[model samples]
Target: MTPPDLSRRALIAAGVAAAAFGPVRSAAGTEPGPIPQDRPVRIAMILYPGMTALDVVGPQALLAGLAPGSLYCVSEAEGPVASDTGLSLVATHAFAACPPDLDVLFVPGGDGTPAQMRDAALLAFLRDRAARATWVTSVCTGSLILGAAGLLRGYRATSHWCVRDAVLPLLGATPVAERVVFDRNRVTGAGISAGLDLALALAARLRGPDYARTAQLVAEYAPEPPFQAGTPAQADPAIVRAADAILAPLVAGATAAARS
Candidate 1:
């Protein structure tokens, strides 16, 4: 039985697990399914302040929802990580203290971008850890941190739309303005919500299209944002104008700071 005290967050995690994995039912709903992953994937996610919850939560949730395997949180220090939303997450391990068994390493970003950008030690840790992993991925301005670590030089990537231009040049990357960009072993997702799309896509890439499609069905992956402003292309001219005006300086300043 699901725990009574389990928050909606936990429930969502459980639901996603039901999606990507579980007994495989064929698309025609008439044949037995094959195993998706051949081996367990060890994932270590960095938890930092101001980090967008969805950025980490979406992927972490996806992995957690998968068959029981190894997933742990890492940080500069072990303890609780406070998010931009004011929610605190408990870290299971420290950066330099991580085990040598990590298969995937991920980081999420936020307004904390400015501070994390200046963290040379954290950047170094990311550089070292990512070098060993099978793949390294980021959400939102997490790309900023990776670029800061010098891992993204010559890589084509994407990030939250507002931060793409600022972050791309910092790493010598060509910014792809799409919601997700996969360049060889490095995968990046734009903004916060795009993390789920990227993760699902990664699953499809790694586990095969059928497995990914199963996950999408289980999670009801169709998007239906109630607001028209979900994308600049879909928003009114005035709203887009106001948003650009409000965000321009912040992007410009961040770009300048990271370049220096």
Candidate 2:
């Protein structure tokens, strides 16, 4: 199914109209706005073992309210999926059960990404769904998965700062050093925390700035990082070295997998 062309000007006009005259509600009192279009926007987020928790949850939290009853957490099976941080989340649907045509198909990165890049089933699912998805997105190392699936070739994308330079080139994608990179329908976020930014940007694109702002306010999405070490450039040289050293093994494995 073809997704609607939600242009920025149209969304802005809609937001302005709603603010000026309030939302046009039916007798049932439902806010039948852009979200409740011909069909709800189908959003599917992939889950796997040893994946990062915050990477998925952060975006989910922001986008959930925007499209209620349209978000899905899918994996190979419908059961508890373990994360890199020892936390487990339940997958509501298996990959096979997910809708074939998705408006947004998202993948999150974590310790399991290197292994997931090699999983034929997961990669095949991503490849198939990405072909039909209106927006294919990833957070952190998840962009590597999209790259490995042959989806990001020739696309300017970003990933976790550590492995992006080493891995994206192997998949023929240009590595970009930024918090978020949008190349057509493919949107990628750097590191784990950047998911929030990616989601907000997507929210604005899908609904409007006013809708995104409402969701942000509901989420209390204010940020005030106490430390200036979110990135290598912001942190001390020694700290950057230490972080690189700790992630060396994972990066090496991912590099080797990407090359293979």
lDDT of 2: 0.82
Name the runs in model 1 displaced over 4 angstroms.
Answer: 1-38, 245-253
Q: Write candidate 2's Cα lDDT for 81-154 as tens digits.
A: 99999999899999999977777899999999889999999999999988767788999999999998999998
Model 2 RMSD vs true structure: 9.3
Candidate 1: worst-modelled 10 consecutive residues by lDDT: 15-24
lDDT of 2 at 30: 27
Which RMSD values do the candidates have, in order? 7.9, 9.3
Residue 239's lDDT within candidate 2 is 97
Residues 1-260, candidate 1, lDDT per residue (tens digit)? Answer: 33222243432333223122222223421222323454445578888877777788787765554323457788889999999879888888888778554556788877677678778888888888776665678998888888888777888889878879756877678899888887766788898899988888766654456556666666677998889787778899999889888767647656865877
lDDT (Cα atoms) of all candidates against the true structure? 0.72, 0.82
Candidate 2 accuracy as TM-score: 0.85
Q: Candidate 1: deviation at residue 73, Å?
A: 1.2
